[model samples]
Target: MNGTVTELTVPTPEQVARAPKVVLHDHLDGGLRPATILELAREVGHDLPADTAESLARWFAESADSGSLERYLETFDHTVAVMQSAPALTRVAREFVEDLVADGVVYAEVRYAPEQHVEAGLSLDDVVAAVQQGFDEAVAAAETPIVVRQLLTAMRHQARSREIAELAVAWRDRGVAGFDIAGAEAGFPPTRHLDAFEYLQRENSHFTIHAGEAFGLPSIWQALQWCGADRLGHGVRIVDDIEVAEDGTVTLGRLAQYVRDRRVPLELCPASNVQTGAATSIAEHPIGLLTRLRFRVTVNTDNRLMSNTSMTKEMTALVEAFGYTLDDLRWFTINAMKSAFLPFDERLAIIDEVIKPGYAALAAEGV
Candidate 1:
């Protein structure tokens, strides 16, 4: 007779929420509160599809779940429209950190394209200053000890990547953590921004490229081989280079093997992956196989509002799908902290002083 399969024990939602988490790929513009959007839209005289916060929230979730990355990104129009002025940027940035604190994110690096917010006649420096003001206010007010930093993103379709990379370097000590390029990945490859990437590398600055989501292996290869990215954003498509056999043996192509061997962090967002059609579902996500293979995998919520998810929600879903315990969750959190662009000492401090102890306490409670 075949051996019986034992059911995996999953952590409760409450326990999962209480566990400490770190997120490296959240979007600032993609995480505004619906009620805040309503108020901002009213002040700015912008129209919205839904009048009520509940309906607006529903609209974002439903609109982003269209299974196309381009369609999913279109939902940001409303969010970006309302976030034009300094006051609006500051308010949104502050509330973003507050929400992260509530979601049990001990450390996070929220990113957005400052160029997008400058449509209302603000300079890039003004935009960065306002957002930093918000982050400072929220950190000061938080009851729990949480650290939030900024990653300035350049739109891949645009030509301002070099300027944005310079902005990130100028603000690195002042609150900015790194740089990134994000947009539709099919036509405009990461190599298009090679000048900006080379500039960043020469300055010893860290950056992550948005690749392997809407595109395939070539995008990943360019981001890593040509651009010298420190990390890969939504790199779920790396699984395309991996093969599994009927006997459960695994084979890794050169790229996949390089990724694993070099410990190039994959900033995976499961719910967002499903919304963008990068993965079919959370249960069948490449994260499952990636984690099993000991890849440098970290869980994230790429867009909280669009994906209708939080760090806790993402972690809870993974626990339900993969039967992850507090230990697995802790490992993901540490991997994120280690992979963060913060100073090495600061990252080590968080892992040793905050994350490790937090997980130990939760495990002590049998969570």
Candidate 2:
């Protein structure tokens, strides 16, 4: 074994795509296929800025790259507009699962606001059922086993937090896995929906808050302390609490230390962070430091379409930027699977049976 090359070769894009991945923070409205968006737009008589899928895709990327949270979220208007009906919702949901399976995702928790799709005369229950039916159909047709669950989200700036929290509980056993509050974190804080968080907690349910992305530490502090978030969505801004001196010594502030010690998972979306101006570049992302510190850091695709990214692409970028090998990828995958809102036994099962074996095989192959 002397003078031997012991390092595992960096995984190729194909191998990375084939790796078992767990997604915890994806948005359903933000991950639609560009062509599907066009078709759905026509079905709903909705006008889009671009006529073809390619143009529409570019428009989404450019729009989201504007570095303004409000502008970035406006791109969802078209996707949500076309998803108002049951058929549209079902189709999008089915295709979402199909795409995830194709991208080699074994388990995913996709979140969306039920109230956003209710403009077409569908009750909240109907909306949830339609999406669940789509997921069921896709999973049935998949050649490889894949599990997809829903996270019922309420707009933090809205008044239906209680209603949405109740809907999540109603469908907890059906397809919904948990609850969430998502929206701009600046003006509308997670504490605005304290009632929803309290309700979920009273029921012994779990939830994540979209915090620390566009805003700073206060947003994350409020989400965790006041709102009782089980996890922090795009908790990237927690890096503000971390200071590295010029002498190369690192110090963690109280908040950062608490997040690490408490094992709170940070759903870090590298590409999406760059596109949204949360991080300057992939090389400068806090994920590098956070991962080094061994925080419960998990990689994700916050918005697949807008970011124009997939799990493979996200992993590949991290590999190139951070010199990550298959083991590092496995670490992130296990973190995500562990942080998932699924039952502890189910999460452990995936980590042991699916995720570990998948990465181990890749390592054995030296990729």
Candidate 3:
């Protein structure tokens, strides 16, 4: 044996939990705590599937684990039902930020559809204001200094994309970071919201499209080529364009090469993807090859409640599946920071001042 000793440096669960994380595609309505949901539902007389917090949490996870995107999305009905009033919206948003702080997320963009919250007679602007109030309160109270922003998502099945886009731009200077188009991706393509995407583009705003998770490459193509999405939310289907030969040589189709060449960020949620039938498991997820090919992959928790995930949990899962070290985790964090919808200088400051230092400290700990 050689005199040199090699020590593997895998990050422990604690180290992963402590490492600074940045998430670009978290949903506000999709992340309420089980206990909070129970309380809110009780106040609103909204009947839930389960009574206890433990059972409610289990119900959400089990319901979303169905191998169908439509079935998975059906789980959000209960969450959205309880968030109609202004106070409920504010409370949920505040708790959302607190949860992110606990999960070691230094920066996050939480998204929700203002249109959905208007069922309780709240105007679109009222919903935005209420959510922002909660965010401001939580940020002020957070001891760890977290930056949270909003991305107004226009549901694809609805025709209010333009109105929501306007609302997002109107609040952009306040706390809204960007805009997005979400919901089922099968019948309703991103092209259906071309006008809203074009408007945001003209306003010089950033946006991501919920593209490749449920559908395939066409969904991704329309989101990028037709709608001009700045980032792809769960662009897992880009793998459909990639082929591996019997000898293990990989080939990328034109669209896949274009995505990589342009450095388009893929907001990948591993657990959520498996739940929605996008990938079979974490080990078989396309993130492994996408990261290997340098496709600007960024980890995200699409729905913390539904997928039963957080930034820390997602990182730990990736580490177990792919043997990702601290360096890999740092790379993912920095990639997300770079791709964030925040101002370039602000993103740089977090990268230079916060993320880099945080990872360096972890490295020093020999984790």
lDDT of each: 0.92, 0.91, 0.92
**Residue by residue across 216-255, what tens digits does model 1's lDDT show?**
9999999999999999998999999999999999999999
TM-score of each: 0.97, 0.97, 0.97
Q: What is the C-alpha RMSD of each candidate to the true structure, in Å?
A: 3.4, 2.3, 2.9
lDDT of 3 by residue, 156-233 (tens): 999999999999999999999999999889999999999999999999999999999889999999999999999999
Estimate the TM-score for candidate 3.
0.97
Residue range 1-367, candidate 2, lDDT tens digits:
1111324557887778888999998999999999999998987799999999999999999999987767777899989999999999999999999999999999999999999998979999999999999999999999999989999999988899999999999999999999988887889988888888999999999899999998999999999999899999999999999999999799999999999999999999999999878898899899999998899999999999999999989999998898887778888998999999999999999999999888778767762
Residue pairs with backbone atoms closer than 3 Å in model 3 (clashes): none
Model 3 misplacement above 4 A = 1-8, 68-71
lDDT of predicted model 3: 0.92
